[model samples]
Target: MKESIFHRLYDTYHQDVFQFLIYLVKNRSVAEDLSHEVYVRVLKSYDRFEGKSSEKTWLFAIAKNVAIDYFRKSSVRSSRTFDAFDWETNQLVSPTKSPDALVELNDDMQELLLALEKCTGDQKMVIVMRYFQELSIAETAEILNWTEGKVKTTQHRAIKHLRELLTNDTVKEAKSHESK
Candidate 1:
C-alpha cells in the first residue's frame, strides 16, 4: 500500500518537484539527488500527511523544506555561478540584424538568470516558482509555507530587483556599443 502510494505520488509530481529543485539548487546533479531524497522522505512520511493541503501543495512544501535543509548543510560551498553575456559585443559581431531580432533573447535571459542568482534564497524561490515556473501566487505561497501577503511582497521585491538588473545591463550595453 505504501509502495503504491509512493509510486502514484511520484508519477503525479516528479517533474514539478524536479524542476523546482533544479531552480532552487541550480546544480543539475545535486537537484536530481535531492529530488530523489525528497521522494524517499515523502514515502517514509506518507502516514503523516493528514491532507490539510492539496497533494501538489503538500509535495511542494516537502520539496521546499528539503531544499532548505540542503542549503543549511552546504552553506559554505558556492551554490552556483551565472555567466552574464556581453550582449552588445555579441550583437555587433554576429550576423543578426538587430539585438531585438534574436529569438529567446539570450542577453535578457542571461541577465535575468544572473540577477536571480544574486537574490536571497527565499526571494529566488518565490521568483522562480511564480514567474519562471508560472505557478499561481497562491500555489507558490502554499508551497513555500508562507502567507499570501508575504509571498506577494517577496515576489514584488524580486521583480523590482530583476528590473533593476536588466535596466542596468541594458544601459551598460548601449554605452559600450556607442563607444565602439
Candidate 2:
C-alpha cells in the first residue's frame, strides 16, 4: 500500500522535483540525494497533505524547503554551475534541419543559462520557478512562501538583469569573433 502510493507520487513528480533540486544545488549527485530526501519527507508527511495546494505545488514547496535546508548546511560557495545541464532546443526551434541553426540556438541557451547564474538568489529562484519550471505567480509565491507581488517584482528584476547580461555577453562574443 505504502509502496504503491510512493511509486505513484514518484512516477508523477520525481523528474520535476529532481530538476528543481538540480537548479537550486547546481550539482547532479547532490540533487539526486536531495531528491531522495524529498521523497522521504513526502512519505513521512503524506497523510498530512491538506490539498490546500495542488500536489505538484505541495511537492515543490517541500523541495524548496529541502533545498533551503541543504543550502544552510552546505559550506560551499553558491557560484552557479550547469556543467551537467539537460536541455533540448525543441521549443526554441521548428521541426527543421540546419546544424548551424541548432548550434546557434544552443549557444543562445548557454548564454541565457550563464546569465541566470549572475542573478541574485531571489532573482534566480523567481526565474527558475516562474520561467524554467513554468509555475504560475501564485504557485511560485506559495512554494517560496512569498506574496504574489514579491514574486512578480523579483521576476521582473530577474528578466531585466538577464537581458543586461545577455546583451553584454553577446556584444563580447561578437567583438571576439570580429577580432578573429
Candidate with top TM-score is: 1
Clashes of each: 0, 0
Model 2 misplacement above 4 A:
76-105
lDDT of 2 by residue, 1-180 (tens): 878988998999999888777766666677789999999999999889888888888999898878766754442334254232112110112112222322445767656765776677678777878777899999999887889998898889889989988888889988999999
Q: How would you encode candidate 1's per-residue C-alpha lDDT over 1-180 as one tens digit per residue?
A: 889888999999898898787766666677788899999889888899998888888888888888776765554243344333322121111111222222344766656766676666667878878876788888888887779998999889878977887788889989999999
Taking all chains together, the TM-score of candidate 1 against the true structure is: 0.80
> Which residue pairs show backbone clashes in model 1?
none
Model 2 pairs in collision:
none
Worst 10 residues of 2 by lDDT: 86-95
